[model samples]
Target: MTLSSKLSAARAGLFRSLGLMFIAGFGATVAFDAWGQIVSPALGFANLSPHGLAKSLLGAYGLPNSDFAGYFVHFYLVGLIGYPLGWLFVFRPVWGRVVRRGGWLLGAAAYGFGLWILAIGGITALAGLPFFLNFTGITWVALVGHVLYGVVLVAVMRAFGGR
Candidate 1:
């Protein structure tokens, strides 16, 4: 492919990847939430859900905890941040490798792990929240949830001819 053709292909692939990202993000969030609500508490977790996180942050600001706003923020971040970042970091890098020998499932799972690090290690710290607490189930949930997200995202992107 010519330089222009390559660029066009990449752009098209990016849009397709973003669409998949949107779907995967929401799916992951829903799974995470359900796990937090139904499973985490039984496993001795408290306020570990995304809604709980948002509620905590809102409490810090003396704002009321709104589930609507929390879900909106969750979905918005998936589309606005997750899509572009996934394309730039995950999709492009995975495809850019000349060898491209790894399975898409592995690549996507690795990408999701990276995202979990960024979210838990970076975002949580930046937000002044404890990265890890006494509870470990939440940690496992986040890690596995993100991995599943990557699996689904890669499956969708590959189906759509991304990379």
Candidate 2:
């Protein structure tokens, strides 16, 4: 192919990958929120409010502590962009290299577990909360929710022909 044609194809592939990531991320985030906010509460579990953590973080930084701000940060910034990009650029690639014969599901699960550590262990500390939320029930719930997020993310990506 000509140089210009190769560059055009590369650009197209980049956009396609990004589009897949965005859609998969949005879907996985919905699954995570549904479990944490709706299903868990109905099943007599604590209703997780991840946005609350975002609100606290915002307030700590002298930003507005409104629900809108919290939800925007949690859903849009982290869910749609951060986590998906992590999977696309970091976890998936590393897993592919480290475990050549490993299944994608397991890799995705591991990624989810890492996300839990990042959020519960790391982000909570940044927000001035106990690491892993002091290992409370909500901590386990968040773990499950994050794992579900990863599974759903990869599943959606695969369903749409992503590697």
Candidate 3:
């Protein structure tokens, strides 16, 4: 294929893959939240919403209902929205690399390092609210959460590839 054709094909792949990922991620988040709302409440932690983290970090700037559910919904939506972006930085270059493998690591690194540490934390800090100080304690949980997100993305992508 010509350069233009190759670029167009790649763009198509990115769009198609991103759309699939977004739908899958959104469904997963909704299901997880459903379980939390229905089952977790019986266990404990009644205080929850779909915009928790966003509320925690940007709560002052926005409305209320600050908790995990809130954060999960917003987080999944925004994260999936950036799906195609992974292509440019992670999966774009592969022309007979001697290694012949490792896109998952590249993509996961972009997710964990770029989005998790830099984007998530940076956005929270940039929100410029006093509540951010509270995050210091549970920051590790949040970090691990993003790492898990990276793993989820890779796994989901592999599964989707099979279909």
Candidate 4:
């Protein structure tokens, strides 16, 4: 193939990965949100709800605190940060080389851990929030949510031809 054709292919691949990441990220966010709203509350975990993170992050930006604001910020994070992460890290080097060959679930599970670290450890620290939340139940719930997010993200991305 010509250089121009190769460049075109590369661009197409990038867009493809990005598109897959976008859809999968949204789905994962929905799953996490559902868990937070329904399951977490039933399980008596208050801090696991999305509102706290949304309120804190939006409040830092001088935005009015509301459920709508929180949900908006939550979706924005999932799309902008989470999706790109899956594209750059999970689907690129991690999935094909390590996960696909032997154990897809293991790889996806590991990706979930990475996501938790990025979201909880990195983002919380950046937002000046404590990494270890006061509510241990919330932390555990969040970890479980992140793992579920990773699994769903990988499955959706693969379904969308991200592999």
Task: Please name the candidate that would achieve the greatest lDDT relative to the true structure.
Answer: 2
Per-prediction TM-score, please?
Answer: 0.65, 0.96, 0.53, 0.76
Compared with the true structure, the alpha-carbon lDDT of candidate 1 equals: 0.62
Candidate 2 versus truth, CA RMSD in Å, comes to 0.9
Q: Model 4: runs farther than 4 Å from truth?
A: 43-47, 61-69, 79-87, 90-102
Cα lDDT tens digits, model 2, 133-161, are 98987998899999999999999999999
All candidates: CA RMSD in angstroms?
A: 4.6, 0.9, 6.1, 3.1
**Top of the candidates by TM-score:** 2
- Return the clash pairs for model 1, or none: none
lDDT of 3 by residue, 1-163 (tens): 8999999999998788667677656544444345435544555534233255566545646756446545653655455555324533443343114345655655554455444555345666665633333555335444544455555655665677722
Better-scoring candidate (TM-score), 2 or 3: 2
Q: Which tens-of-lDDT digit does each residue in 1-163 have in candidate 1?
A: 7999999999987777667666655555555556556666777664356555555555566766588765555556653456446755756586559437776676777777876787666556654678753236677777766666566655655665554
Candidate ranking under lDDT, highest first, comes to 2, 4, 1, 3
User: Looking at model 2, which ten-residue stretch has the lowest summed lDDT?
Assistant: 39-48
Over 4 Å off, model 3:
1-15, 27-50, 56-76, 83-110, 130-135
For residues 42-158, what per-residue lDDT tens digits would candidate 4 score against the true structure? 877754656667677667778797888776767776644655576567555756665556565677777778777777776676556887564367777888888887777778877
Q: In model 2, which residue pairs have backbone atoms overlapping below 3 Å?
A: none
